[model samples]
Target: MNSAFLFGLLGWLDLFGIAVFATSGALAAARKGQTLVTFAFFALVTGVGGGTVRDLLIGAPVFWVQDSRVPILCLAIALIIWVTPVRIWRAGAVDWFDAMGLAAYSVFGAAKAMQLGIDPVPAAIMGIITACVGGVIRDLLAGEPSIIIRPELYVTAGALSAFSFVALMQTGMDGIVAAAIAFAAGFALRALAIVKGLALPVYRGAAEDE
Candidate 1:
C-alpha cells in the first residue's frame, strides 16, 4: 500500500476512535438530562483528553489544538446526541461504543508513537494511555466509578492491541495488517468481557486484617 494512503487510513481510524469516545461522553451527559453545553463539554473533554495526554507525553503537538477539525467533530457529535431521542442510546450502548474506541485508539496510539521514533515499550504505553485516559476523565467528571477500579477486562484489552501492534510492526508486517489484527484482538477481548463477564483474577494475597 502507498505510504500516503496508509497514513490516511490511520487518520480515519483515529477519527473513528474519537467519534465513538465522544459519543460515549455525550451519552453520559444525556443520561443525566444535561444541556447541550454540558454535552459538548463532556464530548470535547473525553474525545481529546487521551490524545492530548499522549501527545504531551510524547513531546508532540497537541492534536486538537493544531487541528480545529477535532474539536468541531466532537461538538458535532455532541449536538447529534443532544438532539437525538434517548431511546437511540438503548441499554449497554455506551459500553459497546467505548469498546470500539478503546480498540481503535490503542492501535492508532501505538502506531503513532512508533512513527515518532519512540521505543516499543513506551509506544505501547502511549497506546494504553490513548485508549483509557479519556474515559477516566469522563467518568471522573460525571461522578462515576473509575474504569480502572472495575473488575472486567478494560485496560488489559487496550494493552493487547497496543503490544500486539508493536510486536507485529517489529516483525516487518504491513502497518495496515498489523493494525487490523491488533484492533480486532482488543475489541474481541473487550466484547467477551462485556458479554461473558470475563475478568482477570483479582488479588488473593494476605488477609486485610493480617
Candidate 2:
C-alpha cells in the first residue's frame, strides 16, 4: 500500500489496540475486586504503558498525552467493565484480548518506528518492546507473575509478528496485507499456546544439565 494508506491503517490499528488492551486491563481488575479508581488506573496504565514508552524512546511525545481521546477511551472502557456483571466477561477473556493486542501493537510499533526513519532491525525490536512491556507493567501492578516468566510462547509471538511485518514491508508487500499476515501469525501462535499448550523449549543450562 501507499504511504497514505499505510498511515491510515496504522491509525485505525492503534485505536483498536488501545481499546483491546484497556478492556483486558479493566477485566483483570474485575477479578481482583478493585474499586473504580483501581480499575481506571489499571486500564489507563495497561492501555498506554507500552505505547507511551515507545514514543518517548523514539523522541515522540507520549501518545496518550498527545491525543486527549486516548486516556478518555481507556477510562470509558474501565467504566464499562466496572458497571457490567463480572460474569459477562467470561473466563480467560483477558488473555485472549491481550494476545490480540500484542499482535496489533507489535505491528504498530514497527510501522511507527519505520515512519520515524528507524532501521528495520531496531524497528522490529521496538515492536516486541511495545507488545510486551505493557503486560509486564500490568502484571507487576497486579502482583502476578508476568508472561515473560511463563513457559508459553509470548514474546516470541511478538517477535515473529514484528519480524514478519518488517521483512514483508521491506519486500514491497502492501502494508495492510503485511499487517494482516503478521498479526494473524502472531495471534495464532499465541492462541495455540493458550489452547494446545504450545510453548518454547526449556533452556537446560549447565546447572540443570547435571
Per-candidate clash tally: 0, 1
**lDDT of each residue in 1-210, candidate 1, tens digit only:** 237634887899999999999999999899888899999999999999999999999999998999898999999999999999898777788789999999999999988888888999999999999999999999998999998678999999999999999999888888888899999999999999999988998887666647
Q: Model 2, 44-83: lDDT tens per residue?
A: 9988988988998888878888898999999999999999
* Pairs that collide, model 2: 1-174
Candidate 2: list runs displaced more than 4 Å.
206-210
Worst ten in a row by lDDT for model 1: 1-10
Runs in model 1 deviating more than 4 A are 206-210
For model 2, what is the alpha-carbon lDDT of residue 57? 88
Q: CA lDDT of 191 in candidate 1?
A: 98
- Candidate 1 vs. true structure, TM-score: 0.96
| Clashes by residue pair, model 1 | none
